[model samples]
Target: MPTSSVVVVSKCSVYPDLKSTVKSLKLSVSDLPMLSCQYIQKGVLLPHPPLSSADLLSLLKLSLSKTLSHFPALAGRLHTDSAGHVHILCNDAGVDFFHAKAPHLSTEALLPPPDRDIPPPFRRFFQFDNTLSFAGHVKPLMAVQVTELGDGVFVGCTVNHAVVDGTSFWNFFNTYAEVAKGVKKISRSPNFCRDTVFNSPAVLVLPEGGPSATFSGDEPLRERILHFSREAIMKLKARANNPTRNPDFCAPEILGKQSNDSWGLNCKINGKITEENGLRKDPTAVISSFQSLSAQLWRSVTRARNLNAGKTTTFRMAVNCRHRLDPRLEPLYFGNAIQSIPTIATAGDLLSKDLSWSADLLHRNVVAHDDATVRRGVKDWESNPRLFPLGNFDGAMITMGSSPRFPMYDNDFGWGRPLAVRSGRANKFDGKISAFPGPEGNGSVDLEVVLAPETMAELENDLEIMQYVS
Candidate 1:
């Protein structure tokens, strides 16, 4: 779609709280050179009456300048290195920052179909037209794309893993929202003071030495994160509470059955094959039998646990806490901060155990990841000099990432928000699931799954019986 002309509203002022927060950030990390991975990008929808090209440019500059004025910390990236010279690569001439392409205004595709059985993580590259990419790993990493939709637009933005966690990302976004609205007061301020939590050299030791020691032998012997349809979750709920059956069935009860069925001999991994009964016997029979028994035991515990009573089905939301480190660094501070949390189940848990059991289990696991115990472990390791080691888990697996759809869709650059947004380059992982805004503010989530054709086909074949968990 050609860039349409829409008169966009401008947020002419930056909030005071945001202004001070940015100022403090700049002061705390003043000595360090700006890392290349910390840039931020945004999009916003403009109703009818878009601005002309010239007017749009002017508005973008005006908004950006004002934002920086209040959030001077952003200017750190534009700063020089220890040699008193800014990195040449930070200049526009060095980075490939450009507007990306968007699907033209097409009524047919406006409401994309809901994806079923999105494989694990990286396979999601198949669902869209473009993806974010990079040439070399750099600090304060950045990627941007702006595409014109027929009546709308789509914007894509990405920051490197080295710098900033999700909280920082949203912190920046909320700042933009307040500034764009010309609000004087910001609801929250970003906390990046690393010293409050860590001495510099101590903070520096985490990325270098901690992970390997802590995570050794800590990897799950078998682990998989799965998804179910909203409908499937409901079905399970009914089965657990069937008055005609056992009113005693609870979340753990339902989950015991579901987990066994889901993970038992039937689950295919490591190229292992199963017989018609979802088992493999003979010499391998002993091993397969153990697997079956383990599944049964775990399920039994789930049923006995009654974990579903008041729980809400939720997405396993993972947030990296590396940034929460003491002696707060700039948004550009690099390294991992991925701390996982569950979105929290909003729907009833005990009642929907059958339908939502899987979702519930996943949600529970995710929430458990946030225990102060887990974080303390992370902090303890950070204090050491070894690089944080990834548990036995491979970074390249079929997994889902937090969706960018909600965050990147409406970035305004003096123009209007884009019509839609999506991700770029499929990552190193496999089955990738992403979430975007549902159609017409219906409050439903539109999920995009990218998976191997075989995995997708298997899921499609079972769609009728699929239940969405959290």
Candidate 2:
């Protein structure tokens, strides 16, 4: 077992000029219920040539102050309006910062093959106090924990998802890194206009009447880290694109020449795909490494849960809407810009089919988010705001977070790039999954999955799933 002691607890506030005059900013519909309960947890390990605790503490505090100056919303607190809508009070209330020491843990122990129980060392680094709630009057929207270990330093951050999505989350860290490296100017600045999506001052209401159920607590969930190397991802991609691999598989429609009618179907400019025509193109031709692995994991998780073949299973994927919306959002828009796109299929159809079928379904559902669909989704939420369903470990549903595209490992705070990056144990909810870029810097993916113990045992031994992994 590994133990840690808190060395310091301080409040980090935004710089003066970044403060907002508007007392409160109403959260967009997408920022309502789900964001309120979710916290983005990240752990980065820096090894060797260690700085003294004092030096690290001073360095981080200074850099954070500079970073927060630009991202003023993070320094604010979450508050609720009379009508039950969640909003950010930009009163310059500080973020919770803690510096701790872990005497017995090593960076090596945190590596992959996460089949064992959740490690105590990593858990201690990313601890979240379930007792804290955003609905409270004075809750910090961001909390930082710096755990000094034997071989490396682990920096863990828990940012309120109600304020920012994965993109904005990383944007904060990357900017902090730049400031730490003595960069005079930041490449991107945040757009704090919450009304970009909702032009009016409409208070968003959740159908559930309140925030979503917090997944925090002592739930009987197991956390496992699975890494799919670059070669492994390529193999999975080839398998998904090959129709002969599965007897019932059909070649997904490929996006060839696009006619005006197909303008939004296959049109992609600068990595932004237009979905105006709906997702009618062949999915196999356009399947990405993320989509391929996601499909495999979805199937394996479903089978491991052993749901009834006749039952309907749902897969909720977090789609970054920065480039998917009309006119596209600013690159540095520092708020929740993710849409939880859900796909429903009968267990019989999903299980009876091949990897290609599952991949196609996943790909199509993702590409279906066009300019019109995104606006329509916002309007729908305005009329009937509801939390994204949090499915159970009984295997009928799954939710995904984070992304390989976010350049998480690149955050080098003057020391060096992280040896490994991880999510906190708080993400260990049954049927939850997180994807990160593999450590090799190649285009590989590291998938962290949380499942019930029995289901995980079954998934570990799954031959088909194991084939694409090491």
User: Best-fitting candidate, measured by TM-score?
Assistant: 2
What overall lDDT, based on C-alpha atoms, would model 1 receive against the true structure? 0.34
| TM-score, one value per model | 0.50, 0.85
Candidate 2 regions with alpha-carbon error over 4 angstroms: 3-24, 82-85, 112-118, 131-133, 198-200, 205-217, 245-285
- Residues 1-470 of candidate 2 have per-residue lDDT tens digits of 53443333444443424565556767776666454464667878878436787888888888887788787778787777677667788777777777777656667766535456556567666545442334434667788888777678888888876677888888888888788778899877778776577443556554453454545445687777787766566567556656444322222242333221221223232244434356644443466657778888988888887888898988889888878877888877767787888888888888899888998888888877888888898888777765555555445778888887777887888879988887775545778888888787556677878888898899988888877775
Q: Model 1 off-target regions past 4 Å?
A: 1-49, 69-97, 100-111, 115-140, 177-188, 195-337, 340-360, 383-398, 403-419, 426-428, 436-443, 464-470
Residue 336 lDDT, candidate 2, scale 0-100: 79
Cα RMSD, model 2:
6.2
lDDT of each: 0.34, 0.70
